[model samples]
Target: MTSPQPTPAPGRVGSAIGWSYVVTAGRIGSSVIVTFLLAKLLGPSEFGLLAMATVFILFAQTLIQQGLVAAIVQRDKLTAEHLDAAFVVLVLAGLGVGLLTAAVSPLWALINRAPDLTEVCLALSPLVLVQGLSIVPEAILRRELQFRSIAIRTLLASVLSGVVGLALALGGAGIWALVGQQLVNAVAGLVVLWLVCPWRPSRRPKLGAIRELWAFSAHAANAGLGSLISSKADILFTGIFFGPVATGIYRLAARLPDMLVDVTVRSIQQVSLSSLSRLQQDRARFAAHLVQLQHLGAVAGLPVLGVLAATARPLVEFLGPQWAGTEIPLQLLCVFGAVNVFGVLLGPALQAIGQPGKLAAILWSRGLLGVATLAAVGALITSDDPVGQATAVAVAGIAIQLTVNAASIWVTVHRVARASIGRFLAPTGPAVLAALAASLVPFATDRLGVDELGPLARLLVVGAAAGLVAAAVLWSTDRPLRQLVTPRLMRLRRTRAATGTPAGAHSVEASATRSTEK
Candidate 1:
């Protein structure tokens, strides 16, 4: 028998961030390749069928976690009683959800009017139990900052799932390819978690012990439900308003462009919440650090949006003729995605400050705004046209989310950092210029014969050149970029004297007090 590798002890937050990046990047990269392969092997209609099925699977998976994962991570001290109680509650919830989903599979399909959803739900229901069993253990790993093991296990599952999905699709499995891959991936990951994590829950759950966690868990779960709405509502609206093929196209467009932003934001948020929770007692450090990460997230993420928006044409072609009609939503969502990138830090930052309730409210409000906007826009804008309707859904959903997130961040900063919105956003100003410069290059090059080149070749060359130019522009214009990008030897010339900064503070409760005014 193979000896189980002992999980690494929690390391520095930066190291955890690094490993999380690997895990996230690996998953997304494999996803991209898998998507490409699947798109080639299957038609848009087939993809649409899978998309409909996925709505339930993702919804159930999200419901299973119920954000108790956050409760575990944010709690100051965890005991065996806490673990045992959480495990019991989570497992029971998982089993119940899985069984309920399986029982209702046909009804769900009939309700959605998608006959294929029944088998999809039944196939995917078991994953809920596996996912539920894994959540507490995974949450514990995250709390311990054990991302190395997490990354390894995730990479293993992702790669293996990708291979299986590809082989099955190539073998003409159609939608079953997707269903099988998801189930295999979940089971593989759960098995790995069990092998690596040494913690074993006691036999019984103490209801009283869980009461202390309920306060936080309740808010977390509510926020998660809201997030569930926000994240999946667009798909629901699309499937309802436009049908499966259009939904599939919209899903495709949303996936590739948003992948980078999603990965970067999730990784940064993971690090942000973990680090900020540690610094919660020292308000100044927490404020300053969050400000830094907010800036970092924007600068790192915004350029990709700009690039995607500029290059949508080539990408649409690269996906082949089957994806021809997806360009509009692809383009519109990229723009909204750019707008949304600025507020990535707001939600997690608020949660870090013990305001999950407020965040939950904002998320739900965001969801309502999204659903309302999507439904309203779908009915009103380009109502006669399917693609136009889909584009409107993408735009409305993301725009409401962006608006709500910005307002939430503004409020959080005022309530917690006692700073003006402009001050909090000040570091982000240069990023806009850098992204604009990067974007203009490709657009300009397209006019200068870049478009005549073969599609893939043109994409690579223009993309690489644009990135280099953007780096150069930022390096010349921004001191932070210069310092951050410079080699260790070259960094000697950059002085930290100018970079040294003071801090500010405000409290979440008892009104904003000015103790350490800037």
Candidate 2:
């Protein structure tokens, strides 16, 4: 991957972020709708079986597209030859994974002792090939920073696929409903991506371009493996020992907090890596970007996760009373997800700066530690207590995630940016206090004999108070929070003067200049 010669313009950066939020918002809205419907329609056992099948599919997905997609996004120059080569790689990998998935489904089913997994895996095999066909087109758009088209396509696919999934579940298709959703999402997403970014490849595969991508791909392959472990190893462990019911409950436990953190982090991530790659040669600009992203992301992220953790009871119940069994696990996952989000940008930052090997190491360390901890904890759970096992996993997960993320952030900030960890995490201090302050509302409200209040009411009280406390703390403690809108306002003034042409549309450069001048 070559370096982006020029830093992305501020207008472009702002536009990218704005469109990314839309993409997230659209997907989230549809996902919430789909999840709620699925939770209501499917029982725990059925969902658990589906979850187990998904681990295999996701593993296949990681191999088929993730490494190549990341390489494409990071590559500074894109040739038809390069894209053609990527498409060829994806096709071969997808075909191999699909056949391998079909071959191993029965063995996985035997291990999990879920006969349904064998069939579900077979049904999902075609998706591997279908999605492989989609990656290059999607990467082409992403590398060009064409997020609006991506957002519209995603939103449309999500809504359409969600409708199909909901209908299937309601019609008593059970586990197949979830399977149907995956299939629909893939087909719909691919179609829309192709429609919007319709550039057909004319060149045959170029070995030279493929070799260049391998420069990024080799380390990226490790990072992808680590990601697979970090994301799915728990589900794998749960399915192996506890059965579909437990795995389903674990899925429910993890769903919301993961959604919240993922949505919040992705809003920045869609632009951060690609945009930041260009400015890496300018250390001052790069450091300033890292500082602002970490601080702002924490200020927003901490309170959301904190509130969710503290109020997991109502949130779990909000899904349905049948899901009450997952309350504690949900709480644990909320906290775990909250702590882990701090390091989300670190791996991306390293990869963007041409240190994919370093990122692979960090991700591998975390993934391995997580898997080991899950195994050790699994060995200790001899009782038939699924919730208890989940609780143990959650606790270990939080501790491990926090430790790894904190250490990784420290190393990345100090080594790469020459910035202190204190500066990196400074925003968290007040954010924590705000979260603590927010927790008090629920405590006080419960004391007021409103324990019978609906989950929504309790959530509103706690969430609103948390939002206020977070704002107050950031406003009081973080200077950047005070002028959050100043840049946009300045840009608006400049835009008016220029009659709507962008004025120095590189936000990081502008922000860095301001910091240095001060």
Candidate 3:
């Protein structure tokens, strides 16, 4: 048996999370600008065509990565041969998947009854190969906790790709503009990843080095595929039943909540896999970090989602009249996003503890349930109204999320991690309560004629009010959170003060005072 892995230092973990947040923040910011510009320049049918083609690309991506990233990061020992083997396997898989995607593009379009999607899929096929080349290198970076480099790659790619997409949109390239964005993003990321990741594949790479990794990666891949299918099932069903226009609208609505999760929950989840994997042998430390990360994720993520749900109408309105059908779905999805934040750590934590099979089983079960419920909704709802159909889909989605995700959390915390259910859930209670409290701020303000202020103004006022309310509630109820955030606040204050810049001294003092009360 191999020796236990060393636990990651707190500072290292914090830095990783910090950089990952930067990556996600930049990505979301660039994407929002690109999305807004493209929405005006293109129509629903155009976006729908791209969305239809992307489902296939996403599946191909799962096969190419095959959970090798987690396997690489979670492994107790590393070898040069392992990296070479993974790189070779993935590159070949990328080429094969790309070719296969191109070959099947026509058939996929026929199935969806959208002839335009054929060229779209063909255009995106090369992206499968381009992205595949970067997998092992990116994995290596994550394993080494080199998130700063990853952040740089992500930010640069998002901006450049967004620029390319917007330029094409402005030039009236329509759907191809969206297509170009995807291709550029993948290529840019691949180039930057190779530059930062110094390891290169050997000339005589051997598959034998991956034999051990396969045992881990196989289950990780299954878990990943299942999770992907579960998340994408609604869109797939929407595309199949409602066609491209509805699919485009639904996709855009779903993207908002998904982006919100990416901002904090998903970033923390990515860092948790690497950090938790390092602490696997230290059960006490592993448990501590696991719970702390979960608590922090909920504290930071759920409230934002809650505010989004409460203020979704104004948020969606900002996208213009073409996006009229988005508000209801966006609100429902925000709830799903909030619940999803709680479960984000489950897969990474399980994989880190060498229980990827458990994660796979849970995810697959959830996927099947999600698919079945969505199919039922599709069959029962005879409404030709794409917006109504999409709304029903969103409702079913959140219901599935609430049931499966809650149970999965209980299983991960109480059964696998050996913590009490209450201990696992206690941190989230304050967050949930705070979210409800924050949401009420919007409800009350809206009742008091906040709608008269216009969408943008209402959004700003509601967002600010909800955020402040959530922060106050969380600060009052959660002692550990105050302890966790106070030092960071103080450090920020000291930096700004020393630099002769303005800072929120009162907020820092309040947090500091609350932390001491613990």
**Sort by lDDT, best first: what order?**
3, 2, 1
Which runs in model 2 stand beyond 4 Å of their true positions?
1-5, 459-462, 486-518
Q: What is the Å distance of residue 165 in model 1 from its true position?
A: 0.8
Query: Model 2, residue 218: displacement in angstroms?
Result: 1.2
Q: Listing every candidate in turn, what is its Cα RMSD in Å to the true structure after a full C-alpha superposition? A: 7.7, 4.2, 3.4
TM-score per candidate? 0.89, 0.90, 0.93
lDDT of 1: 0.74
| Candidate 3: clashing pairs of residues | none
Model 1: what TM-score? 0.89
* lDDT tens digits, residue span 351-464, model 1: 777889988988898888888887876567655565676677776767686788677876788876565677678877777777787777766887789889987887787777
For model 2, name the residue pairs that clash: 9-505, 9-506, 10-505, 10-506, 10-507, 11-505
Angstrom error at residue 171, model 2: 1.2
Q: Tens digits of per-residue lDDT for model 2 on 301-338? A: 67777777667767667777667668788877877776
Better of 2 and 3 by TM-score: 3
lDDT of 3 at 73: 88
lDDT score for residue 157 of model 1: 92
